[model samples]
Target: MPDLAYYASLPRTRGAAAALLLDDLGRVLLVKPTYKEGWFLPGGVIEAGESPLAACVRECEEELGLVPRLDGLVCVDWGPPRDGVDAVNVFVFAGSLTAAEIAAIRLPPDELSDHVLVAPEKVPELAPPHVSRRMEPSLRGLVEHRAVYLEDGREPGYGSAPLASAPRPGGPG
Candidate 1:
């Protein structure tokens, strides 16, 4: 086994988790952060020792004041190093919200400014490119009951088999 120091010296990768929430109309729910320029999905960075699904649920509650019953995994994207940041992994979960849940949304004034439900196709217009690229595949995965793997938000080469029936890490919603 590698020494503790040796293991500690290995590169560390960051993780983040987000949810793809939809309304009964099939419109995607997006949030506008006070600290950021563009809209984002309801999510945030994964804290130490926290699972992606847990992080997603926590973030949703923190940002939107609601805990949604997330469905299966939608996408697992490996974001390449860019700018001055190291590579990071992002996990997206899918779920739908009832009218009551939508009505209960309450943004933290310091963190988020507003929330909107938009057509999936319009995601590209509001979100950053990296986030936009994940939308299509994530939406498709939700519809196909599969999970997609992406590199820098795009599938690599010919793409691998869809994890349609694979056991998801987080149990069912």
Candidate 2:
């Protein structure tokens, strides 16, 4: 039984997935997932009819019972989709949570086991390899910038509607 990280390491098809680097104080959030047991940020595939931002918020609510305020594009990774097979498109968001927000925090336990807040610099110690590979840059960039979009070649310009749509593996527009 290969784990999600193993799948991420192997060769395979490309797809869209999202991740969240949630911050509370000076610590980032991590989860002990059901699929593989190591820690990764909260996020999942962008379901049909679902927008990227919605997916991020929903993933948090579904897994952690907290609806994170969408902080916009932090860093986008291009890779295979899923665990134990290949890498996936990991959309990491540097988001915020209020004290009132914590009051609403709930854990479903089905998707995630328990959540922990780790020091920004100590994230790699708590994060999975694939996740940490992408997380380290975004987490560090956030301290200096309000946001960071880690796409190879892309540009963010005005779009039509407010609905959050997933950009091509290239990155946020």
Candidate 3:
């Protein structure tokens, strides 16, 4: 077995923050990135020394050109290691956009190509499976006014168990 010091010396987990921005029509905002396939929430990787909430705000500004005040976290997912890539911790927060705010969206062409307000039910069809997993529960949390935990974009309880505090700033939970 690895010693405690060995475990402590392991590389730190990376984190990303995203928001589920709902419009008055109860639709969620999805972004098309220039660099990747499928639609994604308006967020990006959290920079070092940045809090997840701050990262969400910054990413929204950069990708969607909207300054939004996010509410408390809705979901925190512990993504599993995959395809040789390091595991990541993803934080999802909830924000709402007025019709005027939606109209004012000006996406950064370099990073994002398009933005759309998708109905909650259609999110599963529009987003990748894992992303949809994270998004669906997050929407529920927003409506239910509670927080939830996930593992690899799934509600903890099955293949991947959920954690009380999954992705903390300093390291993985």
Candidates arranged by lDDT, highest first? 1, 3, 2
Stronger candidate by TM-score (2 vs 3): 3
lDDT (Cα, tens digit) per residue for candidate 1, span 43-154: 9999989999999999999998989989989999999889898889999999999999999999999999999999999999999999999999999999999999999889
User: Could you give candidate 2's per-residue lDDT for residues 1-173 as a string of tens digits?
Assistant: 75989867976434344545454575676778776758877777777677667778778878767667766667776654344755555566677766676556676766677777777667678776656666656765566664454432132344775436736577867
Maximum-TM-score candidate: 1
Clash pairs of candidate 2?
4-83, 4-84, 7-84, 7-85, 7-86, 8-86, 80-87, 80-88, 156-173
- Candidate 1 wrongly placed segments (more than 4 Å): 158-173
Better of 1 and 3 by lDDT: 1
C-alpha TM-score for every candidate = 0.88, 0.66, 0.84
Q: Please count the clashing residue pairs in each candidate, in the order shown.
A: 0, 9, 0
In TM-score terms, candidate 1 sits at: 0.88
TM-score of predicted structure 2: 0.66
Which residues of candidate 3, in runs, are more than 4 Å off?
1-8, 158-173
Alpha carbon lDDT of residue 120, candidate 1? Answer: 96
